[model samples]
Target: MSQGDERGYGGNEPAGHTDDAYSTLGGTRQTRTRLPRGGDEGDGYGRRPARNSRSLIMVVGVVVLLIAAIAFANQGGGGDTSGNGAEKATDAAGAGPTAATGTKPVQGRNGTIASGFAHDEQGAQSAAANYAVALGSAEMFDKTQRDGILDAVIAPASVEKFRTTLDKAYSIGFFRNVGLNDDGTAPAGFTFVSRTTPIGTKTTRASADQTTVEVWCSGLIGLAGEGSTKPVTDGWFTITMELQWVDGDWKALTHSQKDGPAPVGGDNRASSADEIAGAVNGFGGFTYAR
Candidate 1:
């Protein structure tokens, strides 16, 4: 049987003894037990067994066994074991390095964003991951905030180009599509949500003064409000950033994004708009590091 197939005491049959089990009673001898039928008691066969205390006990026993079996199976027992499967899944879910060498997650911050990362491979990876968050944040919607982020994270030589490209990307139509105003503000009763959470980071190439890092991330965007057509949703993507260690810090020379190293979604219930809005407002974002 396939692993996904449901298994019971019987193979694709009802959970009871088969008719053939009564075909013979002794070696080379066959016997049949018959019960007389009341004219109206039978349903086109011998009269059905009358209900009794012993029969009731047997019925209860079968029901209890079935219930226990089903519970065990659902918990990944029997041929459908998921204990190992779950462990494998957990291992697969982790994206980047697992061991820690006592390195600090961040060296310092530039205003609200992280800055002054260590000038090593781990530092470059950390810088890239944190930069991805800053670039993908709701702050990127406004011109001034976006410029500030670009100045802090992008290499000085690449700042102007990055700003111009991002300005075009966050156009009026894009804002409207995400339920934000042309000016990138949320509607009167709505809260705009644009957040990027980096899952892990890898230093693809590294040198004394330059490095390339890949950051696997999941993001949430849209509006949270009553009757909002565009509800906040999550998506996974990866960002590649080439960094230059300049002026005692790593800065982005160029960056690009592509889709997924996404993990399977969980069964958590979707929160309501009010709850989502409240949560977003109550909690603040972090300056992440590897």
Candidate 2:
């Protein structure tokens, strides 16, 4: 089997299911093929090269135009108004990758969530991405852990409101629909999965005391076990977090999510239920950084 055929595992939300669970807060699953037998074939890479070829050509064309523009700007002969702008642009264009900024990714943690980000753009982005992961994890299904997450990630003043709101969101019906018990525990002999992985982050606004960041993410959510009606599945989404710099750290003022800047699915084969469960148990999540 190809690598793509063995990659993702997921199932759709059950009928009549409410979108109160954190995983369904701002995104909906799109139909995707289960693990297939061959690689690259399902990913539009093996036999369908014409469309991708055209895309590649377009990308190359854009790059050539950008290079030409930069070169023309560098000529510095005529039509150069406000030489300072051109000089700045030239410096930016010429600048190459540099050494690390020397900032520690996280100074501490609020429970399992990373905290104490530096008061800067990179730090804010990092904080937002990490917080998104925490909020989207299986831990949020449990009351105690969920409260801890809220307290750890939310601003102190907003903690109570956020807690109350989430409490109502993860209802009993929501748990049952995902193959979990009312208390959010999987049935005997089964493993429930909910995990979010951030692909990247972008800062839309930043200031001394507040910053807004959007985290593009992909996630796995559902149940993995024998005879499970809902299997673990994948989704793509973007979460927008408004953060406030407080007490030498960043905390969430508010957050909202939207459906993805998702990529085309690959042709990986789907793993078995046991394989999905084992991998989830074996691998640990990460503390994201920008």
Candidate 3:
């Protein structure tokens, strides 16, 4: 009889029943009567039930519990929602464990910016991708461009601080150290390009309005020239940013980066200095979005 194997109640004893009494889950109780004990065989209550039957009951109960949990979560019980009526249902459907899984990139409200990030791991990844684009742009190298970006993307209170530090960072001396000419310019017949292209992004941790995002990126930097000591070169690095939902968009509270998780370059011949210079001068960068 084994007390009718109360494991059917998720190994939990029913309320009001002692620890050894019975089993129940949620607000429901298992209704099966105790199996007969192994004695007084002439009476119907004196024989043990089959072990196979007990196993079947436990399996069925567990399956039902699993289905109910999934249903509750799907009905918006255990997850967050945007509360905006216009796109709440659409966003909720795009959510679940893989909110960012769709084929097309999510678009922001006014067009071209990033949106559709949800309240989960996928949302954090989307935010990271967009942030990477913002942080790695050529705009970060120019004072006017940098200020506009900071004002538009950073939290207002932190904007001034970011601008002050970044102004100092993009100074002429800093540019020279990274192989640029003294005036943050390239040498004759050369073009200087410092750019970070993202490979992928992810969240190491997340919560409602805060998250830590890590982006793996490959960058092109250094000065390009013929008979030059420093030629345009490529490197891979990972940038990690601590982000917070500010105003209506995600913004970085702090950002730090480190060098490769890089792989070796291929054996293909390197482009000539003139070729590299022409390509860089002819091409314009994109206003990247995730």
Candidate 4:
């Protein structure tokens, strides 16, 4: 009533009048408004001050500073790289992140399996990887090669134990179930494939005398031929081995396996049996695997 009825706008001012403006965000704001310019016809409502242009500049400057800070942080200020001028890592305790050591591979072999591994964390991981391959290979179905593999890869203290256990495990029934003959040979016109490919190796526990490691692997098993009941299929798994420094090399004292970090299957078409068999026969596997 004081401003609208008869005093403020009705008596002393025009029909339309402007009021003082106030605005705030988190208790910070401008409480001023602009007067009409010299001869401009403006609505009753006033505009913010022309100097408010500084707010836009301030916001843009802040954005630019934020972007620069992010770039610096990403350029190895994040402490994830080992480039020049970066601090070197100390992993003498055998509990460090995995990286390429560029150590020469073991030049010795016990049968087809690698041997003469160094008595260090790297050696432990290498032994675990190769042992997983040997233990999962198609040769393990044949008792003779199986026994030799156990002898080469198992710790001296556990060699006989593993041999006896595997003898019972790989029975004639096991061979037949895997589409192999009684002598572990592929049936006529078919190729039996049981291959394990180690993807990465990790030393879970390590010491001078013994170490435990896990190897992540991708494997293929079954038969490769036309009209085969057991077509080759792929799987992923992890193999854990407890290795001992036996005599002069790393050997498995105990071994166990568990299923995957498997990836989702791709939409690629399955190849024909002839193609699969051809690939298996044409490609020779690595003998001195790491």
C-alpha lDDT score of every prediction, in listed order:
0.60, 0.61, 0.49, 0.58
**Candidate 1 on 14-132: residue-level lDDT in tens?**
23223342221111112222222334453233333233323222222222222222122222211212212221212324445634547786767898889888877788878998898
The deviation in Å at residue 159 for candidate 1 is: 0.5
TM-score of each: 0.65, 0.68, 0.57, 0.65
Query: How would you encode candidate 4's per-residue C-alpha lDDT over 1-290 as one tens digit per residue?
Result: 11111111112211111221221111122112222222233223332222233222222222122222222222221111222233333354655445567886576888778888876768878888888888778887777888888789876767765665456545454454445666668777888887889888877655557677888888877677766656666667777777777688888777655557767556566788799999988987774334
Q: Which candidate is the best by TM-score?
A: 2
Q: Superposing every Cα of model 2 onto the true structure, what RMSD results?
A: 14.0
lDDT (Cα) of model 1: 0.60
TM-score of 1: 0.65
**Cα lDDT tens digits for candidate 3, 6-109:** 11223232122222212222323322223223233411523232223333233222222222222222221112223222211113233234233653444463
Candidate with the greatest lDDT versus the true structure: 2
Count of clashes, each model: 0, 13, 0, 0
